[model samples]
Target: MWRWILERLDEQFPAFDVDRWWGIDDPFERMIGSVLVQNTTWSNAAKALAGLRERSWLTPQALGSLSADDLIPAIRSAGFQQAKSRTILRLVHWLMQHGGVGGIIERQATTEQLRSELLSLKGIGEETADTILAYSFNRPTISGDAYARRLYQRVSGESLRYKQIRHAILDEIKTWADLARLHGLIVEHGKVICRKRSPRCEGCQLRPRCLFFDHAKRLS
Candidate 1:
């Protein structure tokens, strides 16, 4: 299935490229950005993250000293400023209490354990946990978002629960690189061609292998 889809994508979009999404190199930056990106565009999240960084409050240690209200303006661009600010400050306190963000990552906890711990935090969810696990720690977790869900439904003709879908996708892909590349590709694809309301499958790279496209063609 993996090879089939990859071949189809390559054939249809010869110049198709998945951008490397590791913009914030530090694990702490990635972790904070991952949480801040919830229900927001990357541009907004980037702006907020940059705001925090500019004030040198991007670190857990710095955030530990700051109150939630004090952090609101820096992350206001990401929306839900107060709620997210509270969440971020709480996370900072937790990290500081545990020795710091570096201490948390340095634990090298198993993926499951780490995800559980993250979810235990106030605002962190499965998507945020998986994002931190995969992007921050280079763990092999299929980060299932709208992009991945839509791509899966289009290509496989299946409605899947989040965990089930992510697990299934991981099973099909060969390596961590494949998972990472596919995640980025589908995200870009979702933003560009494979929209929710009306996907542009006519000239899309995955149309050749997409179940929806094939079904439509057969009906016609």
Candidate 2:
């Protein structure tokens, strides 16, 4: 079901290129944006990121030199300024110590190891960790965010937990590119069609396969 859904989505929806979508092509900047985006909308996070970019603080070395307090002003738009500042500080320091993502790749580290490392930090939760892993490191895993949960539940007739959904998708994904595409497509689907309330089941191309649509049909 997941694989078919991915193929159909790829054919129907515009491809989600993270670098193009975020407009932050630098891997390090992408990682920092991940932190800024926590508990905030992407536009607010983009504002924080743009502020940092204007200050040329997106690099690990540049950001690592500053204290968490210094980041609050630039990232104030993204709520939880204090916590996010500290989290970004810790992440930068940790990344620098590990010799950057390139170095970590040279070490042939597994995705699980990197995920565990990220989760150990102050503000890095499962979703954030998996996001960094998938988007930044190009790992074959998806963030089990609300969009994913709702979309999957509606389609599969199964309500899985965050970690459960992630692992289940990983099992079906053979490569990072496919995983990224699947996640990107899922986000689009959730936002435009299979929304949390009043989903446009009639317009959704996947209506035939979606359990929620089937149920809705019975009720109607």
Candidate 3:
């Protein structure tokens, strides 16, 4: 099922690049964009990231030096500016105290260990932590977003927790590249086909295997 979905997405978005999805190259920038993307669209988050980059404030030292008030304007487009600014500030402080971005990247800790540490921080939830683990650290982990969650639930006819879904995907797909590509594909599929409202189900490639579509057809 996962492979089928990925293949369909590949056909749909031939030029998809997981790294380009967030418009960030550096691991730290990716982590920051992950946080900024919470409860917001990627375009808005990208704007905020661009703002930070333009000011040369995308670094740990620059973010750590600024107060939340000073940071709010740059990230206002991402929504919940005050809260996100606080989260970013806290993350920067934590990173600085722990030996900056390089220190964390160079640490000999396992992915699980790093994930645990990230989860212990203020605004870092399971999804965000998993994203950092996957994109930032190049770990073989699923960063299950809302798009993936909804798509999986409809496809499997099971409503599982985020961690449960992540574990299930990891069990089936273990390579970092596959996991990353699957994440990007799932997100793109959600946006393009299995949308939340008025989903384009009639000609969707996955309609044959989609539990929701099958059930709807049966009911009709």
Candidate 4:
């Protein structure tokens, strides 16, 4: 069913070019974005990214050198400036300690093992850790974010726990690229159709397979 949804999403949003999903192809930028987009829109996060890039603070070294106060103004667009700045600092320092994203990927080898360590970090929650693992480090793990949970709930008729949903998607996805693509497609679906309020279900390709739609139709 997850694969069914992914395939439909791929069809619905035909312009999902994995190579151009913001700066996801770049590990450093993705890490920054993962932090910046904690509870904000990607557009706002992009503004923060642009601010950081303008000052050459995109790199772990450059960003790590700055104090939280130094970063607050630059990432204010993303909101939660105080906390996110500290998080970015911790994340960059951690990355540097681990010899960067590539080094962690090569050294860890197992997503679960590395995920545990990442979860221990100050700002890295389950979703953020999974996102970094899947996109930054190029591992085949599900992010299990709000978008993912919402999509799964609408399609399957009920909400599974985060672990269940992540495991289900992980089972369906085989490669890191597919994992990234699945995240991208689901996020696009969330923003464009499966919105938090007043979802545009009439034109959604997945409506036929969506249990929520079926339930709504019955109620109507």
Clashes of each: 0, 0, 0, 0
Question: How well is each residue in 92-139 modelled by candidate 2, as lDDT tens digits?
Answer: 888988898787667677888888889999899998888788788887
Candidate 4 lDDT by residue in tens digits, 1-220: 8778878888998888866865446878988998898998888999999999999989988988889999999999999999999988988888899898767867945878888888888988998888888778877888788888998888887788888888888887788887788898888889889999999999898998888898889999
Off by over 4 Å in 2: 14-16
TM-score of each: 0.86, 0.95, 0.90, 0.92
Among these predictions, the greatest TM-score belongs to 2
For model 4, state the Cα shift of residue 29 in Å: 1.0
Local accuracy of candidate 1 as per-residue lDDT tens digits, 71-117: 89899999988888887876667667766656766876777887887
Q: Candidate 3 on 1-220: residue-level lDDT in tens?
A: 6767778778777899987775667989988998999998888999999999999999998899899999999999999999999988888887888797788878888889888988898888988889888888788888766888899888879887788788878878879898998898888778888899988888587887889999989999
Native-referenced Cα lDDT, model 1: 0.77
TM-score, predicted candidate 4 vs. hidden true structure? 0.92
lDDT ranking from best candidate downward = 4, 3, 2, 1
RMSD in angstroms, candidate 2?
Answer: 1.4
Q: Which candidate order results from sorting by TM-score in descending order?
A: 2, 4, 3, 1
Clashing pairs in 4: none
The C-alpha stretches of model 3 lying farther than 4 A from their native spots are none
